[model samples]
Target: MQQHINEKIEQFFRDYEKRFRDGLAGNVDTASITSAFADCFIEASPLGVHCGKNDAAFREAIPKGYDFYKGIGTTKMTIGHVTITALDDLHYMALVHWQSYYTKKDQTEVTIEFDVTYFLQHRNEELKIFAYITGDEQKVLQERGLVS
Candidate 1:
């Protein structure tokens, strides 16, 4: 039963990622992008020292910082792996491995890889992300070099 629920959550995240990428590419509507981000939170730094505890905080902070993708340029995100751990019948945690290429307003492109963990809870039968921790893989690579 837990496995089945986890699979469903994984599917939801897959669809969410696709919608986010399409929106960033201008192939999908902004509403979809925002909706996908609903109930989600992200840590402010790679160390996990600071974090966004809820959706409202994420929404407020994103517009001021990372929301640059909305107007500044395009971004393509590809998720490689996702691991889900069940906390209970109504809660779960997921670790996602992903890479993204961002095209800045000046048309300059940069690619980076990162890992993020999301905490999700079932609300009204809907899986809603409640918290997230983001890490910077490039910085880690620079400090420790590549590792297989």
Candidate 2:
């Protein structure tokens, strides 16, 4: 049987989704999203590249990605298939599917979809993400012609 979605986790994603939509609309800042993650948060992209507290590669990559999207006339993004698993009393793991629609630098409108799992910790009554393992950054890049 399929487990029901958790309340807190659902609310968390709802908030995140709203913020992400705002970001795509250029109504909110990207730092707001980045701030939600831990300083040492680690991320393993779908391509298997790792970055986070132990690595800073994702920092540069993320911002560049934002710029790329904006340059490509990205106006909206949708996030779906969110599921949160309670890892313990104070920790949770979330799996989310995200799709971004944008015009490529060449003015081609395309959408890219990917899945990511995030490890979140509750601290001071807030959820902070410490890790994210993505499912297909390479495929996303290839689809967008960002990679050959």
TM-score of each: 0.65, 0.73
lDDT of 2 by residue, 32-53 (tens): 6666787777768645656566
Over 1-148, each residue of candidate 1 has an lDDT whose tens digit, in order, gives 7767878888878987887676565455444445544343554455555534434554454444335555433367788889999888787889988886656545666666778888788767677766777666546544432212
Clashing pairs in 2: 40-53
Q: In candidate 2, which residue ranges exceed 4 Å CA deviation? A: 1-5, 46-49, 53-64, 105-108, 146-148
Model 2 residue 104 distance off true place after TM-score fit, in angstroms: 4.0
Residue-level lDDT for 48 in candidate 2: 66
Query: In model 1, where do residues sit more than 4 Å from their true spots?
Result: 27-67, 70-74, 103-110, 136-148
